[model samples]
Target chain A: MKYLLYCIFFSWGFSLFSQNKEVLYGLDETPQALLLNPGARISNSFHIGIPLISHLHFNGGSSGVSAYDIFQKSSVDINTRIINTISELDDRDFFTTTQQLEILNFGWKNKKEFYFSGGLYQEFDFVFYFPKDLAVLAWEGNANYIGKKFDLGEINTRGDLLMVYHLGATKRWNKKLTIGARAKIYSSLLSFSSTDNSGTFETRISESGNNIYEHLISNINLSLNTSGIASLNDLEGGSATNKILSRAFFSGNIGVGVDLGATYEINEKWTASASFIDLGAIFHTKDVESYAINGEYTLDGIELLFPPIGSGNSAPPYYDDLIDEIEESFSLDSIYNSYSQMRPLKAYASLKYNFGRPVGGDEGCDCLNTGENQKYNQSVGVQFFNMFRPKGPQFAATLFYYRKISDYLTFKTTYTADSYSYNNIGLGLVANIKILNFYIVANNLQWYSNFAKAKSVSLQMGLNIIIDENK
Target chain B: MKKNLYLLFLFTFIAFLFSACVKDTDFNQTDDIALTTVLELDFIFFNINSQNFTDLGINNTIVSDTTDLDFLDSEIVSENIIRADFYFRNTNSFPVSFLAQYQFLNDNNEIKYEVIVPVQAGNNIDPVITEFTEIIENNALVNFTMATKVVVNTIATSSLNNINGNLDLQSKATYYLRIEE
Candidate 1:
């Protein structure tokens, strides 16, 4: 039971988290916001992020169960509460975690209708599903049920540590249409994944024999894929910190991706926008390790008897016999090969209606509203986002209200419904002082009141230097 | 206006720190649920056909029957079986021991668990039952067969049908699950 329990953790070797940031998408208040939709119009002529402090994000969420499920001070015992929670959870329920740090970022409007931006950001992403049947058998002894096959396919998970270098350009034809595209190069530092395993393990009594019940592990075909991690994890493998750090950019194991977005203005108060990101894949062909088991074996409680040694006699291969029997019956193979994983493609679309002061109206040119200084005092919109997760596509729909309180201050709030939470409330604010700009956004504010009951939480903030040509 | 801008920046940063998702949650980590049930095998209809009880100069013959045991659990359990408790008795005066064994098999027709209960032969035909719990090596249970075979000690003189005997069994099952807060 202990060994199997250990395997469950080692078997979970993959991560169970996803990427879902609905509150910050299409906000247009922060330079980093453009990462979600490049076509978003910015009044600032140029901006430079303050290095490491430019953009920092941390978010994690769990669905199907929460902290309240296990840590709550209840009348029931801890184990009782746990089993009760497991009973309610299914395979579709998952846990998600994501963290991204921007190291270099800058954008400039070379012309009134054209703009350019680029940056380097290192990101760690992980997502995995809990294998319930495998967990139950590892914890409980296989005793009462003489014959039951526990599924091996329940083990499904994926995780990666990667760095991305990107450059983007936006073209604004008129006040009516703005389109942008971004190209990204991804370098994977370390990764491990083991999803889609198949097989079963069972126990039964011998119909005719001197032994008790026979234990059988049959038709086992499970595999674990890894990269970079295997060589570093090896104590004698010889890997230097400086050498590994140098490979962070332009590493042999690299992938290319792209992001495309467009914003179209239908009228003075109506607008529509959409963006697609990370549409590519990385192929792992170097420093990769794969372990697989593809065979079956059974044991009939055979007890080997060792007789006392007499003079002039040789020792028996007691342990050798067992090893030989098992080796002959089961096979474990380890190989190094190449594998490819698609980037978690993300997309967002929104429809908005702006109401407030119109641009250039004071100039008596009401016919032309397109300019570098079109300010809206208030706006409301609905946005939908989708990300390709390891399990499947995950979607989030948000309804938002935004306000420009002053010339240098703006605020936004959104109500969103996603896989994690339905009553997700988010708040974002952007403040401009002189040439220094700062913005901070947080989601699932209600969960802050009771951290233990919280299932999901997210926060993003950044600082940048901006120059508004219009001002 | 300058003071207000600073205040807004400070307030937003402070709010972000408070609602951040910082706590780490461990999944399926608790170990404390165990359940046990009985598997009763009543020899309701044991009729010896001519193939098993023929008097055609046959010195000895072995007769047996295998019945499928049902484990009605919804959630899939592991094969890391901690242990199994076996209890059964011989309630017949047939002299020879009644060999009973439980055969567990997976979908691939592979035998995972094969347990047998040996009833000792005494001078007096006794109705004695024995019980013992042994740790199982298998981690999962899919299906099993309860088989009974009789070894004849006497020379074959006549053929007879309807061999009767009663065997009872009870097993305790325990599994661990976790509840995270």
Candidate 2:
């Protein structure tokens, strides 16, 4: 049991944040850019990632209060701080996390000038929307909030653990346009989601009843679906670990998806690109469980209607009747049925203009470089990102500046505005020593002064081996 | 050599960022966390006519009725409740006064706590309404929680065989809870 708990805790700690690789976009030194937009032009003829270290990403953040708000040392009581924080948060606020690790990755450029890449990666994604009404109800109870309806619809959350195997091909279809598509196969290990609920609980003075007040639960429609969880309860520690590890392969619930991307060069200095990823659904069949409740019920206290004069009878079983009605109205049952869930789709687009002296001192383009116009050493661009979530689509915009500092070193800086914050500054570095490549990217640099106060953060780093055409 | 210098500078910056990134925070504040909640719930209610005071069509005084109410015996009520307030309102149209008793009994049928309410007489044309409140706290509150059942007794003060009136009773209980982590 202890081993299992440690494993679970480690896995959760390892799984951290969002899937947005904003810094890596359009970076041509390393092959990691291909993961963001497969059509992105690369300057290398071949690349192979160091297994399990090629791409490590962690991205997550809350749109509401940070941990410092509740844990900071202050004169006010901690409970007061918690209550104030809870009051400040709204239902639309959410916390989301995504983490991915590349296990195997390699690609080669063919004689036909086509780049083909394939790899497998494991990913974990989670999102939970803050339920303000529910939090108030639990903290203060209904005694003080008479007649106020607690909105149960605020409850919305989803999580998934899965592995993806993919292969993609990038083609410079013409001198002005490059297009690419990647096919993906997903193996889901575990999944759980409860969304789109509706209900209300209220207490009000009774209009006509034996009691002074009535308690009501009305218009309730809530459900939860999960896969690969119920069966784990019946297994022991080692068996459970084996089951999860085995499912990580292609033996678990399966799905398929495709990614499409394109880059266009309208003129010598103008460029635009776009990519759409994870547009597919997973079908959960084995070990599937679902629960649902829908109905309305009310309780206005038990009424003991006494018999009139000379009528020889006892009072009805009022308490029993109330219990029976409550049971009938809120009966929940587990259902075993297959279900399909669509992956959270993501989209990115950017427009950039290249300028500054070309590498090799404004000399003619490198004859051996077969990628995009290999003429610029510096560029500035604006990028837009949108990710579909359980609530709706979340958007972020960034303005970036990229520069090739030297033949072996590249640097990029960005300012971004997203739901979490408006003042997010990020930086990225890509370096190549002979055929060895390494890169590191991070955002929310200002929070490095006090990490606990930041609402969101992102970091990605990787190592790979590349072979240039000249080599 | 310039590339190596930049690489070295970046590595040192990253190490510095990690070494002193977060400010000091006291997570031990959780030890002082406590929550207080109040819940108001309806307990018992009833309505009776003059006929209930007559036996074999004969006028009878001091007639009584008893019913079982065991909600206060619940474990959650016993464990979390630090204080309780019982509110009662009675409307009587009977010519005779009345007495209402709430008897809280333990497992051995021993009365651990008892509450009595006295209602004044009223005429059939103008019903008299009366209210009563009982607040239990401290050691008395703990004793009240030990009750397994409650017996409510309604008694008449005089003959009501021919009294053409009704008596109505309504009551509610408010519990104050203290929870600590």
Candidate 3:
């Protein structure tokens, strides 16, 4: 049990990056870029992803403390290292992970120049903030500190596993502006959250009381809510897979959301785009379970009263009575309540300055070449991403240089600064072979030499078949 | 130009793959992990009025009470408790000094340990306060866990027919535990 606890603690505490895909944004050759910004221009007339192999992404890491900080070979004792690490880590430090797999994806452009795209994808996201007061209380207890209060509000965490089915359309309304919107239907498989807790536990010296030390549990309002978990047991057997597949296909607790995006051309030399995704909530009405504990209690030991002589009565069970009083004061209440959870909304915006010679030497007069179709061989841009979290919104800024090396290959490199690290470098590559398009993106290149020390890392890759209109 | 571009792309991809490498780390240090914690908790207390003793027969000089302490028998306390310090404060407002004897017994009602406190005498306007501290560790701590009950006896210095005061007792315990893998 001890090993398991430590293993889980250290594994989650190791280096990680948040769920922002900086490298995939603004790359014109890859169709996956449309997922980041629906208004993104694509020269292809139609495209089809190869089933589950279309797109895969994984990003996770902690903002503070890494495996090397404690497990690195050192002469100091491990216990001291652990203590020092705990002391240095604050409540604001958080661990987060986001994973996504594209099950089906395809898109097409109609005769009126409206680009329509849709897909179904599975995603899992989790985030847990460090509970500093609880860690200190568990490690040092209340013996050394006589009047310290452990804040229970520091315990904040949330996790969800769900499938999203989405469809979107993009069209150029005029010569200078393009706009798009995607409608989404979410099917949640499992979800749990424990947030907005408020409480404190403290021990103090009593000035005038029956006992010397007094213990107080004040203003406690803690709750945990879960959905689609209890029903998993009912889905036991070979049909469990089928049941889950069907639920993910749309039979589970469902909700609706939408993504809005736009691209604007200021002139022939500069372009700007912005997008907002996952602006929706999931209503968990089926198989929901919640528990709540609220109230305040104080104790000053068990008070014993001596019976009068020869009263013919045994001494009252003072200890048992105290236990009963405590149970009554701080009781756990099981609740069967339905609730709604908002998705983690994300916002992206970027500005690019296009220069250098246009691809294919701008020698042909083609209508499809008017927007984002390898018109410029080199460009410099800045991108900003923000995702709403339980604590607050997390933000990242990236400056990138995109180069179209040849007709069949292109690359983009980026330098990003966020809460995780200041020296994060990322790279993305897209290769075109006939009708087959392949792309890969990786982040945090500086720490690749010593990966264990890096606070965050992420990878994304995908493949698709596209047919260009000008072909 | 096309050949050079292909070669550059291939080289960049290989470099990206080869750049990720793990440095020196010793995960085996987890085997030596240990956590030491100390917890302060309220133990037992009481307030006895002198009338209870004065109501006794003219010759009676002592009164006793026994309470079951099931917490000492719990596995978590018995196994994790390495050392304990018990602090007791007694205030007496009676005319006569008293001897407070505490006897710890096992489940079968056998005495395992005993503690004696000498309480001072005082008047109603000025009560006497006496504090006692007991530390049990090593072999004594092992024997302490065997106790599941405590028998407290309050013995007056003499006949208690005219006593008119209160005896207040307050106590707490601090336990030191070392939990490791």
Candidate 4:
């Protein structure tokens, strides 16, 4: 039975490889190559084929203050006010900044057939922020010891990982007309941390007949902390961490989509292709967890009360003494937490053209030498193949232009009013060595838009390997 | 085709497992308490006929050396008593319960005589008169009489004393009344 299952899997994979023969490399327009080029497959004779591609594409400018950030800022201000009142301070300052490291695509593609291919890709990011610097001061009174200062430091961390499966195929009617399509399956894992700390000091002044006669002071430090790791598996299995972090639930949904592309021979020497890609959504089983933590302290003569911290089934009482002291002196009340989720859709498209022809010469190459080639090689005096064919090997020079129609195409949550056009203008040189069944590509890219004043440039080079048993 | 079926089965299993294990708990609801305001009063008083109270036809009458003085028949005497009653009622709300305590004060700015009745459930209860007493001293002829009628209940012609004070009457007096139900 196990062998039978293995044979079936092998046959399925074998058929996919036999389908993608013609294309040297799957196009870069779609993150899900297999989904876009479902017909793409390894050539008939080759047992295996591999293509390593690197993409350095950036879309969307810096996100403005997220609704979460706005809420966090307001919460911080509120917490600060409560802290100040409890400490009897005239002024206080607090600061926070959130950072997210997003990875959109990272994976390897395998050809299963002459016109078909499939693979998996990963996309995710680690998001965290250290909201520190809660500085407070007690006003100076008649007693020299009437004022003191302290800081409350807190850090928050959260992240998630997404894996998507893609199936694609490529079809070539002849040497000049080629088309492709692909479909994707998406899934993800998520987790986060909830922890905070606070410190406090007491300032006291002796009053004689409505006047301050002397001053006394004391200091108390308290820390409230809670930490746990949670995952989709754990969440589903009723893990303790899941309960502690119920706020962090991660689930994924399957969405169906198709990528369409067509490459045409403009002439014997030049070819052009346009593709609509990455146009799909991941129906989420549930929203991702966004969390936050807020803490405060108060001072009364000789005692302090650190804020209370609660998680799942555990509530710490180490700060109880401090909290009681402060409450009796100067009351404190405050709350803090961070929450947010990402939109599930994204869309993209590109148009490109190659300006060179096949390098090796053959009798059938005469087609390239026809009058149709004159338009691409003016130096050849309309002789076609003589001017278009490469002397050493077939190489192509290419240029492309691409843009995002709407950021909101994927999920409405991704839309922004500052939305503007993103354009990429680049040059690429491709060398095809038919005998070795491989190609080398070098490219220089630049991306810019109305959103930013400066343009970002990157240099990329990679090799494409194709194995064809028929050759 | 079997591979596709297996893939579908795998996904369904994962979904079922996830759905069954995940738990969502709701927060408890809390309610806020509301407060109401109430009114309170301190004192209420009314005094009439400081002297010769029997001038008004009553059981208590003083016979002088010459004849029985028909003080009640004298226009000036009756007019004086009427003026006092009018002064008390006009100076404040009738049933005195209708007015708040702060409304009364003489030119001297002293609250010598005052009545306080709380306004409960949109209605005011009149002040209760708790004591009434009269005494005469010296050779001066004097009499004491009083009449009280409150909400259909009447106590009239109540007399305390009648005598001659050789000099001006010097006596300490007191009166009392209470609201009926």
Candidate 5:
């Protein structure tokens, strides 16, 4: 039997993520709703968030295999379960995570139909596609993978931490249409990715006269690009959330973006709305470090030779020469290059049927068609969510019911289907007690019944002071 | 007083949500890639003219030209690959068996892997040139982190004019990478 061997020394752990706030779309009464749709329905004259308590949100989910798929106790071997899980996942499957904290938020309405708002918030987004080829190689080894071309293009992911400073204006053009636009300055603190890689890892018999087979690494250009961690701690560099918060504002890398949204009344009972948010990009130039390995090599065996340090040559440092030769073949280059990344753009659209605003026990604004306020206490609607991702565009369809329980409490429930889960149920509660207001939104409610099996989960909560004047 | 109570409740709810978040466990896996290219070591070791000389009272002795090796210096020089099967390719025109030895050295001129293997002659039936690898049981030269060079020495049994056996080294390097979140 031919004895083939190779030597490789080191690697580092890195990751990426992405985002979408589905539940908050089209829920206009809460101040946070303006983030999703700047032209969302509003009945208040002024509003402000309670310092750090204004808004806090985090979302994470995997579209492919859940923890229960491999970890749940089963009669089958754990290795077999893991293999099955890997088999079930493909390149299209991805993991997405997002975290956001609103530092400041405030809005005020004009004497007329014009309203203005502005806010500063920190956001972190990460997403990475499952490298199925790598998984197959890991579980089965190259012996069975002979002749199969495991593609390296499947290794695409992106992660970023940034601060978004935004200001927006909403104007009621007429009795039926309200439009809004938001301008934002994005200051990126951290960015990391190894996207658009190209290569093929394959194994086959030696082309020439030899008993050994060759594992060919052809046309590989795997790059790891990162920025914004110069002053971070050595041991707890990327993990300390407090460190990230400390560097949230005024990161050297900055870019500009815009959000546009509009709400229109199709008729007396039918209302439709659409919004396109995060249409921007951030340029990373400060503290940038880019690493690249772009080349090819072939290996049949590794027999490294070294000077005998002592008697009998018990250990010869092993494969130092082979490692050197492979390094020659597949060179790694480190450079400081500036790059720009477009925001993870998302689109939202909704169509709702209003049963007319319920006459509340308290005296308040009741202008139903002015396009500046809502007179409906109950409504049913469907919202379509689409987020631009590295692999492709992911979509979700949501059907929701909303009810106003007096003037102090309103509840909304939604059923959704997306790439992550088919039975995603969401709940949102908005409490408006005079000037004091609080809201909480949670998606994938059914998963709470079995957290271990959940493919996705999201939560958002906020507190604000609002003033709704009845004319 | 009602507003104060509402604020208290909101603060409590926020506290509860934060507490509930705790820590989430995420799992991920990744594998590295390596290319195994087989180089006919004969190309580097077979640059010799047929030798015809008597040495130490022995007639018709054969010797091969020395082929110098210089491993390149790049950051891809890591020691993380698993060893597997390897073989030697033989296309030489020898009619009889012989002895072949290979000596590899590091930058500081230290002999790391030394092995003497038998070579089978080419024939109409049997395989030629038995494979020669650094058959040291101790994995001494497996994790070498420095630059290296290789030299091959051989001897023929028959007093022939064209005594030659080519050397081919099949190279295979594996990369292992891990991704954690």
Candidate 6:
């Protein structure tokens, strides 16, 4: 847990370090090279670029669960021997449940072009499970013991995980177009449980010849149970020694995806680019478990020797077999098998334009005509992406503002928002100098009429080293 | 361009602040009304010699001449007359009614009898005795006498259980009182 937490925090911090000009101020609308900014790639050579990135996503929605009456009316024959030998207990009632989920995503990215950009993401979720109580009554083999009762059990389990990894490359076809592709692998783990035990019993007796002889008795027992499956115990325990085995089974699969991007220098101050990234499927291994309970009775001396004659003191021949049947019948492998069939896939596209003079140049723009010109540059962009397969299309526009406060100090601010329907907002800041690049970024700040709640905020600080190829 | 981006940033920041400050006045309001259905009962003890007995003018009045029966004292050789009675009412101002019954039995035994109680709708402020049966005597302890006492209050009615089979009873009987709408 601690290591996973560290990885998540580190990834978020790294994302802040690799802030793109478009993502910072909501100005860039097109995808650049996988690691380097669109403008930076034009200035730098084929020098390998490894950029660490992070993302925070959130989702909230309303859902409901329904219930059905699982009471099956059955005509059970009352055999004296069967009733006496195996106490006649009531059949267990059945109940169904439905639940809803509110989700949040926090992610980190480490990209090494031509190698891989593995990511660790934490998906926080809140699931609500509601079970309706069913009316049930059990027979205790006596006339005076008939009572009414219902189950009162509810399932409330929260917190889950969605982790992923990606590997791809960015290849420049020419100065006008850049193409890149990324393959992403991801998985989700969800689980929850609850149990309830409640009911009533009654007994009656008759008076005869100066003595109160026992007449009848009835016992009704009600029990409720619920539960959720989380990650294997290895992941639950934060021991470094158990990392190997835990990671082995915890790791799901690897999928392939490609990113194709092209940058057209439309003019001296305007550039446009577009890219399609991460189009693939990942599968998880199968694991399953189940739980259940049962009740029965034995013959009382009075019933064995009295009116219910011929009832002997021997265990019912089929009692064990019946319990075994129940155990095998409730196994959860079928449910898990169905869930394993679903896959995770995502795709996105962006368009952006930069309006500024090239660094250390005089012919680009009048704003940079002087060496001491301290005025800042500005850019704007928009992006559209599909999250969780084809669930919904997300649209966002960003504004980028940069100012040189001093020779060694610079300030930057970004504001971006998705479609008005979902209303997701993001803000970021960066302090860049010769020795270090420290920055902070926050995403999903408010709820749109279409969205549920705030997603996540990422803060990061790291050293920025610029290495000259000649050195 | 820088100034334009700054203006846009200012506009978005103000918009976000405005949205964040927007209060949700529409809310689902729920009154703290507990809708109860289950009425659990506990055992009722009738002390023969206790002076706390009061004639509420509801049940039969015990005249001064009537004999006092004490089943607890071994020296008193009187018939153990255990009578269990349930009172029903439609507490709601509107005529709320239900079909009620009393179930009596011994441990691991057959049910003795089912006594049904019919309730009328909108008949508030009335206590109707659903059961008034007397337990015959065999000198054996009545299961109710040895069990625990429990009082339950439901939305429709209130119930009292005199016999709790949780513990070993020297002479206790089990009785179930259930009401359904």
Candidate with the greatest TM-score versus the true structure: 3
User: What are the Cα lDDT values of the candidates?
Assistant: 0.63, 0.80, 0.82, 0.27, 0.65, 0.30
> Over 4 Å off in model 3, which ranges?
A1-16, A233-243, A309-313, A360-374, B4-8, B11-15
- What tens digits encode model 1's per-residue C-alpha lDDT throughout A1-471? 423433433222222223655666766657887788888776667889999989888777676666656655555765566567666777667766788899999999884657788999988887767666665554343554467777777787888888899999888867689889999999988888887688887767655332445567788889999887766764443455554566697774798999899888888688888999899888898889999878887765323222223335533443356557988876788889899888889999999888766544354533322235344567799999898876778888899988766556667889988887788888887777778888877777776665546567677888999887766
| Candidates by TM-score, descending order | 3, 2, 5, 1, 6, 4
Q: What is the DockQ of candidate 1?
A: 0.07
For model 6, residues B43-94, the per-residue Cα lDDT tens digits are 2211111111122122211211111112222221112222333332222222
Q: Where does model 1 sit among the CAPRI classes?
A: incorrect
For model 5, how does the per-residue alpha-carbon lDDT over A31-105 read when each residue is reduced to its tens digit?
888888888767677899998889988777778766556445555554566667778999999877788889999
Per-residue lDDT of candidate 4, residues A27-124 (tens digit): 32222233333332222222122333422212111111111111122323423333343343211111111111212223233353235555554443
Worst 10 residues of 2 chain A by lDDT: A5-14
How does residue A389 of candidate 3 score in lDDT? 91
Give the TM-score between model 2's chain B and the true chain B.
0.87
lDDT, residue A279, model 3: 92
lDDT of 2 at A350: 94
Candidate 6: which stretches are off by over 4 Å? A1-166, A184-277, A286-343, A356-362, A365-376, A389-424, A444-471, B1-101, B104-181
For model 5, the stretches where C-alpha displacement exceeds 4 angstroms are A1-18, A208-211, A230-247, A298-332, A356-376, B1-93, B98-121, B124-181
Top-lDDT structure, candidate number:
3
lDDT of 3: 0.82
Interface RMSD after interface superposition, each candidate:
13.2, 4.9, 2.6, 32.7, 12.2, 20.2
Give each prediction's DockQ, rounded to 2 decimals: 0.07, 0.47, 0.61, 0.01, 0.10, 0.03
Q: In candidate 6, how many Å is residue B112 off? A: 15
lDDT of 2 by residue, A218-337 (tens): 999899999988899999999998998899889999999988899998887889999998988899998899998888988876666544324355445566677778989986878899
> In candidate 2, residue B158 scores what lDDT?
70
